[model samples]
Target: MGNILCDGSPIESDPRYRFQGRQWETSMMDAPCNNCKGCFLAMFCPCCFAYHLRVLALEGRMENYSCCQGYLCPTCTSKCIPGQDSCPEFCLCLEVTLCENFAISSTRFYIQDQRQIMTDPCDNRIIRFNNCVQILSFVCHILAIFFRELRHLAHLLDLFADLVYCMVQACMQAQTHHELTLHPTAVDYGQAPRTITQQPTASDKAPLMGHQAPPAYSE
Candidate 1:
């Protein structure tokens, strides 16, 4: 099947899809400095910021924004709940409120997939950091079995690492938002309806032949 926007409009002709793979215009570390407003919003009000980014991924159509990029309800369009026509918005809000990290990650993945943007070194670094934290946490758990004091330390380390991870994720979201602003998707939603006019064909313009022509009139 061809590429479609969140609003279910076909976007096979979108310019962004013309290039199969490309790197982000700005790195994650530089995003906060480049777009201070986005960074501030992301850091201070991540839930709202995540929702806004999701809408941006949908080409600025708030109505088209979905919770988890509609992966939770692949078959349901517009409304995920039975007999409820306007449940998507509520669902999205709830998702952002309760599952902020998942919501933000889904939006980021959606944007990247639509634009064919590849993960950069910064993304790999974040992944490595998370991996290292997990490994350390496991080691700490094993060490805590012998040393009771290490148990408290492990809890403290986990809490600190979680805070740092959240901060890093917020920055990543800001970076994605800034990059999206620089290179917006070309979805058809929220635009004026198009009107198509059919041009006259060659046969329609051809002169009438033989008997089909009108008889010559006398002066």
Candidate 2:
């Protein structure tokens, strides 16, 4: 008979281990209202917002976060790219500007992992809705290939779906920024050692008085 208990692997070695974490503090829809600044940045300039979130995830250590840190960098090197040292800010700027979605998603995942925050149900629903819309748009495109009348409608659907998807991404980024504010990392406290100076009072400045010698000893 094969020994079932003889395996030397650790219990956590299983790839199917369930992730345990707390739920998000606020839903994505509510996040924008909760943090107006974050929402404004996300909606107007998503690339900058994504880069800010990446930095926030690393506890404000901008140098630590690089372009495609975990995705492209299989080895997860500290440097932006292996061997050739590159500026983190430049690489991250390029990443967020060119690959905004990937940058935002990666930063979200990184923050979630570090803080052990579970994905909100609203996020799942939005993602599913986006996927369904994309599929429907693709189907519309396919049908338009045969029915020429649907070509304009298909193009419109594609454009609308893409716009919605972009909006959803922006909202999610705003939500992430809000969440970071709610649960700040230790480094956010600004706990660097500081020397405190106190003014000297008259009592403190008084010289130490020696005990008087006995009169008999003086004689």
Q: Which candidate number has the best TM-score?
A: 2
- Candidate 2 — what's its lDDT? 0.59
* Candidate 1 lDDT trough over 10 residues, lowest sum: 205-214
Off by over 4 Å in 2: 1-21, 72-85, 142-147, 186-219
> Which pairs of residues collide in model 1?
none
What RMSD, rounded to one decimal, does every model reach? 23.6, 27.0
Q: Write the per-residue lDDT of candidate 1 for residues 4-66, one digit (tens) a residue.
A: 111222133322223333666666667778878887888888888887787778775655655
lDDT by residue for model 2 (1-219), tens: 012212222223211112343556567668777877887888888888888888777776765665555644435534435432346777777778877766776776666545545445456556555556666777787787777787788878888777766667777787888778877773343333222233212122111101111111111
Best by lDDT: 2
TM-scores for all candidates? Answer: 0.62, 0.65
